[model samples]
Target chain A: MSFKTTVITILIYFYAACGATAQEPTNYSAKNGLPTNHVYDVQEDKDGVMWFATNRGLVKFDGKNFKAFTIKEGLPNNDVWELYLDGKKRLWVFSKSRYQSYVLNDSIYNFATSDGKTISPAPIYEVDNALWLRAGYYKFDGAEFKVQNDYATFYHGGSQQVFQKHGLNAEAAAVSYDFIFNQYFLIKDGELWFLNADGTVLKK
Target chain B: MSRRDSQSAYRFGNLFILINDKGIIVINTIAHTLKHIAFKDLNIFIQPFDTNQKCVFVNNTYQISVPNYLLIFNAGFELIEKHPFPEALEIHHAFKDSRGHIWACSFKKGIFLYTAAQLRTLYYLKGKK
Candidate 1:
């Protein structure tokens, strides 16, 4: 074979090898010991164990096998919605029933107020070691959540006119606020608009 | 957009990531610059709260789950790699474990695990003539 033909052959083999090495993922489902296939969220504990919140129950995967926990194991409900791992490694489980519970020492416990009232689920924000909900702030007092007054306040102003003035249809936009930067981000019709805290358009 | 259509914005370091059914927009909050990537196939199953888990920052790269693909972008908002999933699988979120394995949760199918190779070095073996 000619030298030119050999070099071309080698280059073709090299490109083919590169394409074959692209990663392929492995799937796990009910056929492989998962409690159910409808997994809502996944989180990793401090011990490097993966936990998944599913419609049927909460699952624990130890890199090899899947172990599931259900209402019988103390979950508020089987339809788990979300899982959050706090700084202390506590796994906070949110159920579709709007019940908030936390996993400590492998046991699921529902969150309640100090007065024994069930607390409603909301967007939880951790500020200065306290958990702040949309309604107010609460702190865990060894056994239950207690209300705290020193929670951080979030922005909730009506800025529809500001968006409309900037040529965006406010009714068709979705808005989110950044507390740290004190800015508002609006998205509509595949365009993103940025605005200052005072509702002045910064960018489009 | 329907009333139930999901949309959200998250702050990651100096960048703010905004997602809707249309596409994803990444804004550099400090520089007041923005970058938008339109989605070819829209995944409307994305819940508003699920946005917090949609994108993960690891090894200075952002791994975002969009429809049936996991896109990896550099810090400067440049697409470095794209990993496609089965058309039947719709990824809801992607998380990178401490061991560097990416675990993707699907809407109907089960979770998928991708163990990325640590190094990619090519070698040529010569055969006897």
Candidate 2:
């Protein structure tokens, strides 16, 4: 073989080797013990049990086996849209069309929302002993979900209005209390902002 | 007549909504009775997101033609927005990510990521050749 052709062949082999070494994500589906292939959300609880919210039901993967919970198994709705692991270590399951709240303890427990209305499947955050739920910030004290004081400010209404206290224009993505800075950190629209105790934005 | 090959299903209030080759099917989970609505002109072939928070409707008027437009329905099943698909992409399914981004899949092509804030198709993939 010519030296030029040999060099070209070696380059092709190198490229193929690199492509073969690239890792591809392992795809899981109904065939692989998943309840349904249309998994919307996934979460891992404190106990290391992986939960998957699928179109058919809620599936739990304990690294070895897959357990599915459906309407036949006492779920009010078959379609599980979202899953959340809250501060209390409770697995909160939200459905697409149902008003009942399904929580996972030793098993799934069904309960009604505070207003007997369906909660929108959105992001849920725990902050200051309360929950930043889709509709608004609320405190669920076992029996009922109570709306917090700063509901109007904390709740996003799709408007780009600056909050009165924080002077932030966007809605908060997540909030965390920083012990190092002795302040509260608010992550909103990918930007991090520090807040004072009075909720005013602290320029930093 | 019953439509076969269901793409997706969701719950709206007390009704279990299913999207098949037909437009939309509403079934009462408790009564196990199908509620028929006078759904006209909407040949909904897909139910992109599992969450009833939003609905994306695609119409394929021609049997062999690709859909040109997409209808977005809010949680209430009201028409919220209508988007035209890019020139020749055939979308099969779509879903919302945890970050609230809408992603659509194509049978021949790969996937497309759409951002609501930008009101445009942010990314597209034609899949590996």
Name the best candidate (by TM-score). 1
lDDT of 2 by residue, A93-140 (tens): 777443545555646677555656655554443444454444443446
> Which residue ranges in model 1 land beyond 4 Å of their true spot?
A1-25, A86-89, A112-157, A161-168, A172-174, A179-182, A187-204, B1-5, B28-32, B39-53, B117-129
For model 1 the local lDDT of residue B103 reads 80
Deviation (Å) of A108 in candidate 2: 1.1
Assess candidate 1 and give its lDDT.
0.65
Fnat per candidate, as a fraction, reads 0.49, 0.00
CA lDDT, candidate 2, residue B115: 46
Residues A1-204 of candidate 1: C-alpha lDDT, one tens digit per residue: 999999999999986675455334678998888878887778888788999988888899988999888999988788776676664567788654434688877788886655444443444444344443332345665565665533234353346555656767766776766555567777677566778866787787
Please, what are the lDDT tens digits per residue for candidate 2 over residues B24-82? 44444334444332234554333233322223212211011113344555444554544
Model 2 chain B: lowest-lDDT 10 consecutive positions: B57-66
TM-score of 2: 0.43
For candidate 1, give the DockQ: 0.36
RMSD of each: 7.4, 17.6
Candidate 2 regions exceeding 4 Å error are: A1-22, A97-106, A147-204, B1-129
